[model samples]
Target: MSTKRDIIEQLEKNYLFAVIRGKSFQDAFEIAKASYEGGIKNIEVTFTTPNADKTIEKLSEYFGDTDMVIGAGTVIDDITARIAILAGANFIVSPNFSPSVSEICNRYTIPYLPGCGTVTEIANAMATGVEIAKIFPGGILGAGFIKDVHGPIPNIELMPSGGVNLENMDTWVNNGAWAVGIGSALTKDITSDDYTSVTTIAQKFSDKLKEIRSNN
Candidate 1:
């Protein structure tokens, strides 16, 4: 497995974080693996997925030995964070900031990306050594929000998720997103039994991200 620092760097460099939120562990695992095959090295399996810990464990065991990084998402508290960490999660992500969660992750030297909707939230999360803040519900907040936040905190790293699709993903990166969390956009119409579309979309997303990076 890569070091925590390496995992953090990968997320920034790749600019693509595949969010795996499925109904079951089997389903999420396959989706995550398909995304990985599609070239997304950073994956986040939400805790809301049934047997999330097992999914994390399975994926971690599979990808931990490679350059791929897998993490736990939707972690709301310190306990959940710790559970995921021990389950071999390379990092932790939450919908909102939690000091306890941050503290625990800090103790493990694990990277934490907490959801932040405003400049104040971003600043606070950054103060806790969080490398990147997520502009959650990015669709509602819009790519412009990232630009607006970056105006003053130009040095802060931000990854916007939610409502991010091929149509508008470029907008976010163009506006100053360090990375992005793709959910339904990447998995739309994809099911465990039908993953060919998942791979197809993943490749499109990966190519789009590369194209955007070249322009930047």
Candidate 2:
């Protein structure tokens, strides 16, 4: 089993979270496999999918056997959080912070990346042992918001989601983002039945992240 610290270190080192929302299990699995090949170790399966649990299960069974790690995204409550963990989710991510969700993740000893917009929410989430807090719809806040909040609490780790792409990826990492969650920019090719494109995009993001990490 991978320890919490191990997963945390991997996230910090990789600096990229491949956010995936599959319409079906096969689609999700294919996308995940492509991502793994492209060097994305962290994958987030959103709950809104038709059979998200099963998708996570399949992913965990396949990717968990290797160095890759899986997480549950769009997790709304404690019930869903527990379900995802039992199904083999190594981490939990929510669009917004929830006390119940955080508590459940704590019980499992898994990392939680709950969304927080304001300083107060971030502080509250930090109190619950959340090492990283996600800024949803990151385009709205942009890099300025991250610099502003991080200026005060330099220790707080942040990940931006909802508008991240290859073009602006550097801005987020340069601004001190522990990682960035990429969605359509990484998986949009799946729609055209062109899975190879997924791998190409994933590799591009991974390479870019590594380049910035090296420079910094």
Candidate 3:
């Protein structure tokens, strides 16, 4: 099997990973489909979401035929990461850097993207052999922050999450983000009665991303 870093490399090559965090597994699944239709081939279902493990299983089965990869987010420990991985998570994302969690992913060959905000934290995550690191609360840190970090650690693959949206996605990508993790911005209200609207929003976001990349 390929290593976790290999899986993450493939995901970065693909360009996007839809992040879903909500109160309902069914709703998260619906939103995930909308993202898939929007051209996103990767999705992350945060553990904070209700029935998160089941959500991963259902999404794994639902997208079994496609190249789409489903992962578990907000993983804080090795046990939760193991459970989620066993439940069919192709990748694992943590809100904070945890060497133990990274160790587990390395053992299972599952991709791991751990969260970090400061240079020390980023360095710590990288020291554990995790290549992709999530810059949480993007709105607070901003694209400039990412650019600043890249000045010193140009080799680290950085992804911005939290408060990422259509308005700022281009800036984030332009500023050296390997990819971005979108939550409420992309999944909010996607499970409403208006499925078409949900799909439309998803497509719009995806289209915008393509447009930005094309111009770049």
Backbone clashes, candidate 3:
0
> For candidate 1, lDDT tens digit of each residue in 118-139?
8888888888888788888787
- Model 2 is weakest, by summed lDDT over 10 consecutive residues, at 186-195
| Per-residue lDDT of model 3, residues 52-152, tens digit only | 99989998888887778889999999999999998899899988999999999888988788988999999998888888889987778888888899899
Higher-ranked by TM-score: 1 or 3 = 1
Task: List RMSD in Å for every model shown.
Answer: 1.5, 1.4, 1.7
lDDT of 2 at 78: 97
Tens-digit lDDT track for model 2 on 1-216? Answer: 457787788777666788888878778878888988998878898897768889899988777668788889999999999999999998999999999999998888888999988989999999888889999779888977789898898888899998888888888878878888988888766656668988998999888877876988
**Any residue pairs clashing in model 1, and if so which?**
none
Error of 3 at 5 (Å): 4.7
TM-score of each: 0.94, 0.94, 0.93
Which candidate do you rate higher for lDDT, 2 or 3? Answer: 2
Residue 110, model 1: lDDT of 91
lDDT of 1 at 65: 64
